[model samples]
Target: MVTVKLLKPYYIKTDEQTVRVVLAYQYFTLLINQRVFQFIPIEEKEIRVSRENGKIENIHDRFAFQNGKTVIYMSLVELISAPNFLNHLHSIAQPYIQSEETKSVTLKEETEQIIKVLEERNLKRMIDQALDERNKVLFDQLVKLL
Candidate 1:
């Protein structure tokens, strides 16, 4: 049987890097030297999150550093984990996640507002799938709850 896994938020740490977000799941953003790096799933790099006190030594990255691309050791200046970051990631990721017809115009807005919109869209997709599958219990329950 195919064991499908549900997507959920994750925090992971590697010996070389501390990746807080995984692309195509939630969001990934890295700010280095006043530059912002957003991770998209298509990059196929399989970005992983690292725990606190992680190090980036020996990780070869081309566009992340100003002095050079290949980084040996580095330090983080500041970190922001508010929903606004998530919204920013969502805005950047939406085009890749959704088709043109369903894509919404990007706007500078609050994080809470954007999260609500995303959640609603996800719910609609689930309900639609349940309805299409013709599962009596799931469809009926979701239809009533929704």
Candidate 2:
């Protein structure tokens, strides 16, 4: 499964010679038995602008899956049009992004740990089977020699 989120709005120049507004968004993709599924995990958070100072903010999140791999991302927009854009962005991202003061674990780290455990288990099984076969062959040879 792959997840993606829009960390910020992506502005693209269109053929019409105009800049298009794309909502910062996040999505996720899942693959099972050669089938692929895509979904948007985060709903459209309202874009808020503060009148006190020029600042604008929006949050978009998404995920993606390709070639049996999954990725997640968060989309955030902070325009200087509003005074509190930075503060709002920080407040929203705080739960997802780790701070130096907080001991937070990542999804990649957890996946790696699980993979290491499984690999070790498989390797031990292979070694045991090989040793068993070798012992059987040695015993047969000894019997023949006797």
Best by TM-score: 2
- TM-score against truth, every candidate: 0.24, 0.28
For residues 1-146, could you state the per-residue lDDT of candidate 1 as single tens digits? Answer: 11112222343333423443333433434544444444334323233322332222223422121223433222221121322433443333333342433323333345568888888788788889987897778877776766
**Runs with alpha carbons beyond 4 Å of true place in candidate 1:** 1-109
Candidate 2 global Cα RMSD: 20.1
How many residue pairs of model 2 clash at the backbone?
29
Candidate 2 — worst ten consecutive residues by lDDT sum? 11-20
Residue 8, candidate 1: alpha-carbon lDDT: 28
Question: Which of the numbered candidates is closest to the native, going by highest lDDT?
Answer: 2
Error (Å) of candidate 2 at residue 140 is 20
Error of 1 at 6 (Å): 66
